[model samples]
Target chain A: MQGLFVVFRKELCDHFSSYRFVILFGLIAMVSFITSYMAGVHMKENLEALSKTRFSFLMLFSTPGALFSMVQFVSFFGPLIGLVLGFDSINRERAQGTLIKLVSQPIYRDAVINGKFLAGVATISILLVSIVLVISGFGLALVGVVPGIEEIWRLFIYLIISIFYISLWLGVSILFSILFKSIATSSLASVALWIFLSFFVTLGAEVAANAIAPMDRKKETKPEILIKNTRIKERVSLSSPMVLYSKATEIIINPMRKTTGSIVMMMPMEQILSSRFQNPLPLGQSVIIVFPHMTALIAITLICFAISYLVFIKQEIRT
Target chain B: MDADTIIQTVNLTKRYGKQVAVDDLNLSVKEGEIFGFLGPNGAGKTTTLLMLLGLSQPSEGSASLYGLDPLRKATEVKRLVGYLPENVGFYEDLDAIQSLEYVANLNGINKEEALGKIDKLLELVGLKNDARKKINAFSRGMRQRLGIAEVIIKDPKILFLDEPTLGLDPEGAIWFMDFIASLNRDRKITVLLSSHNLSQVQKISHRVGIMINGKMVADGSMESLAREKFGVGDKEYSLEEIYMEYFQEV
Candidate 1:
């Protein structure tokens, strides 16, 4: 425990002293402020142009909607922060020739990796949470209403989900740090992986599904294409956690809004409950679906951490 | 197996792919002795040091420090050992005092104790006046001195220094030699230092182990090895010449 604390303190202090924390927080703050301002402008325009109806206090419930969009934006940039913070966690020590000095101290190699992960996570968490609070405060003030218990609950869930998503990226960064020996290589590898997951993975999954289960040529004139497309869409949807979370949130937030439109325009749980059936899946079932995504996020994070630990332990550190 | 033996490596070997860095070597360093590990570049001095310090594992045999296996009981061994690598660097933005404090914290020293000792260590290493200056502003010699201060913070029973005086000026080199001598003589610290500077090693180390082509070619007291292995003659054989002679035979 003491050894772990030592590594944690060293990493944390280094983060602050090296301008890592400053740069990360500055970027997150700038991005969040911009996103909030944009959301505010859109909301103001809708109110002025559409009707004289006061901006609904219920729009504050849309904090999750804003948060969801921002979370996606944050994810795109989060990995860069993770890569920068973690890419040199070990390699720089080896390059600077401090690995021997550090390992020679009374500490386990696992402790070093754990401490680094902790520091990186802590730094990101603090910056992101601060942004969330700032956006939430400004949003509440703009909407001009006190959020109800249910709305607050949804926002809390959104915050927790975002944290898990960030953790997933952090884990990938640490894994890259362990696999590559130079800071440049590690950073590049992490960014590449981030790009693959954030963009290419979704596109690739779609292309793959289409290729494997192509539209039936014989039934091109039939309505089966629609049904096949729906199935393919659902399968492709599973490839993206962001999509799943958004779907689940929409379902729980406003089940009353329903659509017989394509599955793509399907309403969230709240709309489904109010429209399709007198009673939707009990609150518990709705939570169950949303719950697995959080679990998946956590599980992936742990797996990344486990892989990093193995690589670090087995690493020669000669570089 | 004696309690006095600070380090014992039995057939310890490290291989990078097909090339053996430290091939099947046995070595022992007793407590309170300045044991110099001498070799040319690529002769596996750093590899051997890393294995002994538990930073890298050996492919074949085993190593123990103070009766504990470095592989299995690494944390325990590390607690009692301080290592200075060939190129020592600190967080460039941190001043001397802050760097030392960071190291002290890693070594589990209490904050109050670490602060007090940081002052004393900075004074000891002649960096007290420049403690507030960032490490990037420090000269190579100053960095080396600070490195030494970091390693010795816990006053470990054993010290592993790899090329401690490699880039130092003559005066700085001499100061480092004196510091090592004092640690061994006055404080009874066991030192296992690897160096390519043969003459400096001879001056400070009681016994020197000469490695060639990943093998220990000679191991004995400085005088005995010099006289017996190199031969006593009117024309003196430098340590480099002796090293070449041994490798030539292989």
Candidate 2:
């Protein structure tokens, strides 16, 4: 345990002093602030109508800017922060020959992997907390809206979900670092997985839905087939951590969001017209909606970390 | 097992799938002796060293350092042993002092104590002037010297060095060998020196082991090995000669 703390402190210092940390932090913080600032300005412009709305402060995160809202930006690119931090975590040490020297110390093998993971998590937490604080400060200044207690709680939960989402990628990249021997291979593989899971998985889900329940325009498609298509698409998309993360975070940040299922199925002509009078669900209900998503995100992240841990412990540090 | 034996392996073996890396073998080094570990590449010298250090698990038999099973009591065994790999590495971004301090902290040394010892160690390794220099700017000989300082930071009971002088010039290698011999003499740190440089190993080793094809073909003092193999009186055989004879027979 003492060894774990020693390695953790060393790795944390390494991460902080690294140039890549500065670059990645600057990149993410700049983009997030830009999107949130735009959202704040956009909300301020429509202040008269939005002032009466509950939890209006959260619009800074959910309201779209020129291209994406703050939430969308995080969902799409936050994995890059995680992947960059961890893709070469183990292999770089191996290549540098530091790993053998490290493990040869009077420390348990598990300490090295556990300490590295905890350090990465700490780095990610620091990055996320500062960004969230900066965005909230900007939002408060621009929108002139003081968040209520419930709004603060929602924002805090959003931050937690975002960290988990990004950490899933961190675990995955660290796993790749252990499984592959070359830094190039691990980094490339991490990026490829990120691209496929976050961006291409949506396309893949659509394609899978079409194959499973294709809608033939020649004849009127059955309602059952339409429903099945939506279900299949949702099911397939859920396989991606990005999809699960975005869905969970969107609901957590926006208390008005009612369900995680297909929005198409949840809406109909009359329901939309009548839904205006429906009160926004409370935080407890919002949490209930995304509980499954959160559990799955946490589960996959743990599994990734566990596998990497086992492989590293059992591996021979020959290099 | 002798009471004074600080390192011992009993029928230790390692198999990488169908191919054997280190075959069943018995080897031991006594306390305060410079035992040379000589073998050609792929003769399992590195593999044996790794197993002895508890970095690799043996498929058969057992190894003990100070009567503690290396596999079961790895941390304890490691606390008493220090290993300097063929190409020992340090964090390139850290200076010599910072690098040694990290090793010191890993061994549970306090900051003040570590800082004080690191200064003396840098001087001992003749890197006093470069103590503040980053490892990236260091020459190979300088890095090896820093590596020597790193291994002995914990003041271990034994030291295992693999190809310690591999990249040094002749003069540098000789100097490094003498430094190691002096460490053994002054600190009584049992040394297991593995190298391809037969003459250098022969220069300082009190006893030597020659391994081939994962097996220890010959192990003993130089005179005893020559007397047993040649059965001649007053005959001398260098480690290079004995090493070549084993390779020829294999």
Candidate 3:
């Protein structure tokens, strides 16, 4: 326990002091700041329309800003923060010959891996919380509206999910760092995995959906075929961490979002009956809607971290 | 095993797939002795050292330090043994004091106590003036000197040095050997120095062990080994000739 704390403190200090960390933090903060600012300005212009809404304050986060919402932007770029922090965590020490010296100390082998993992998670939490608070403060100033207690609770839950989502990537990068001996190879492999999961998975989902449910060009597309296509796409894209995280955050941040699957699933008759109610979902209902997604995200994060921990403990330190 | 033995290996073996890295080797070193470990590049000297220090586990057999199994009581064994790898490295972004402080911290030394000890160790290694310099700016000799300070930061009972003088100049190498010898004498610390440089090892080692192809080929003092190979009354054989003779035989 003592050794673990020692390593954790040292790693945390190193993370904060590294130039790479500062640059990455700056990039994320600047991009997210611009995104929230745009959303705030748009909300401010349409105050009368947004005033009747249940969670108007949260629109600053869920509304489209510039090109994408703050949630969407984070889902796309947050993994980079995780990847950069962990891609070289172990391999760089091995390459520099510090690993042997470290392990030779009177400390349990697991302490090294556990300490690094905790430090990475801590850094992610710090980054996410600060970014969310800064954006919320800007939103308050621009829209002249304060978040209610329920809104605060929802935002807190959103932050937790985001942390878990990014940490999944951190665990993956740390796994690569342990498997590959060279820092360059580990980093390249991490980035490649990130790209495959983030972008290619969606494209593959489209292809898979099309192959599964072909849409004929000769006749007008049937609603049944389109519904089947949407279902297949949603199910297949769930294989990706980014998709899972985005879906979960979208529903959590926007209470108006009540479903995880296709809108076509809601029958026309049912839509007519439900259209009379413009009330947003309660906090409990929103959480229940995304429970499966949150579960999958947390499970995958734990599994990835468990694998990295095992591999690091079992690996031979020959260099 | 003798009562004074600080390190002992019983049929110690390590295998990577079908090839053996360290064979069923039986070796022991007593407390407070500078034991020279001489071997070629692929002779498994480093592998055995790693196993002894609990850094690597053997596929078969076992090793013990202070009668504690390295494989099981790893933390305890490591507390008593310090290992300096062939090419020792430090965190390049950190200065000398910071680097040593990290090592000190890992060994569970408090900041107040570590600072004072670090200052003395830095002065001993002649790195006092460069205490605030980043490791990236340090030369090879300075790194090796710092490596020594790091190894002894915990006041370990034994030292395992693998190719510690590989990159040093002749003068530097001599100085390093002398420093190690003095450390052994004054502190009563057992030293296991592995190197390919026979002259330096022959100068201070109370006894020497030669390993070849994952096996200990010869183990004895200079006088004993010379007498066993060359009959009594022959001119003193340089470790080079003895080492060559063993090399040719093997």
User: For candidate 3 chain B, which ten residues in a row score worst on lDDT?
Assistant: B225-234
What value does the lDDT take at residue A182 in candidate 1? 79
Per-residue lDDT of model 1, residues B1-250, tens digit only: 6767768999999898999999889999898889988877899988888888777889999998888888788878888988888887677877898888878887889999999998998898899899999999999999999999999999889998989999899999999999999988988999998987777887888888988778998887866666876577667666666666666777
C-alpha positional error of residue A254 in candidate 1 after TM-score superposition, expressed in Å:
5.6
Model 3 pairs whose backbones collide: none
Q: In model 1, which runs have C-alpha deviations exceeding 4 angstroms?
A: A16-24, A37-68, A75-81, A212-224, A248-285, B1-3, B230-241
TM-score of every model versus the real structure = 0.88, 0.98, 0.98
iRMS, model 1 (angstroms) = 1.8
Residue A197, candidate 2: alpha-carbon lDDT: 88
TM-scores (chain A) of the candidates: 0.79, 0.96, 0.97
The better candidate by DockQ, 2 or 3, is: 2
Put down candidate 3 lDDT per residue, B1-250, tens digits, no spaces.
7899978999999999999999999999999989999988989998898898777889999988899998889999888888899998789989999999988998889999999999999999999999999999999999999999999989989999999999799988998999999999999999999998899999999999999999998999999888877878749998988998888898
Looking at model 1 chain B, report the run of 10 residues with the lowest lDDT sum: B236-245
Judging by DockQ against the true structure, name the best candidate.
2
